[model samples]
Target: MSTTSDLGTHGERIAAAYLTDRGLRVLDRNWRCREGELDIVAREGDALVFCEVKTRRAVGFGHPAEAVGHAKQRRLRTLAQRWLAAHDEHAPDLRFDVVAVLVRAGRPALVTHLRAAFS
Candidate 1:
């Protein structure tokens, strides 16, 4: 069985590729600060996106995206602010996204991306 960290890494890779395929330019992956970590930082047109990736082997618990709830949204917002403060560049638009990965053995993984998932 794959470890949790392995699953997460796989999901992030899938998410990054998925985003790039959809025209989002990946700027950073796994960006960390004293606040927390942003799974994927990307640019889509004029927007800067902070993505959160959630991976699951099965839907026994719930949809992977459901893990990013209200509290998590708040935290992500805080992290985005911290990221902006540390960076010298500016983005006219800012958004949050969630990438859900469903992993099954011997089958191609399923990926779902929720754009502008939260404020």
Candidate 2:
């Protein structure tokens, strides 16, 4: 079994590839702020998307999307605001997305995309 960090890294890779295949240009990986971390920042047709990637070994800990509680959402929002402030330019349409990766034997077994995951 790979380490948790390794699983996270693999999940990010899978997510990036998935988004790229869908024509979303990835801008950044692991964008961080005082509030929290954003796994990926991407551009899709003039829209800025802040993506959260959750990786789990199985369903034992519950669904990955369910792990993102209200507090996490608030922090994500704060991080997104800081990201936009730092990358000040024309404000593109902003959105939040959640990509859950189910890993089994160190490989991605399933992937779920939740668009506009939070407010």
Per TM-score, the best of the predicted structures is: 1
Clashing pairs for model 2 are: none
- Tens-digit lDDT string for candidate 2 (1-119): 35989989988998889889999999989987776678999998878988999988789879877888898888888998888887853445888999998877755468898999988
TM-score of every candidate relative to the true structure: 0.96, 0.90
> Whole-model lDDT, candidate 1?
0.92
- Each model's lDDT comes to 0.92, 0.86
lDDT of 1 by residue, 1-119 (tens): 45999889999999999999999999889989988899999999889999999999999999999999999999999998988888875789999999999988899999999989989
Minimum summed lDDT over a 10-residue window in model 2 is located at 84-93
The candidate that wins on lDDT is 1
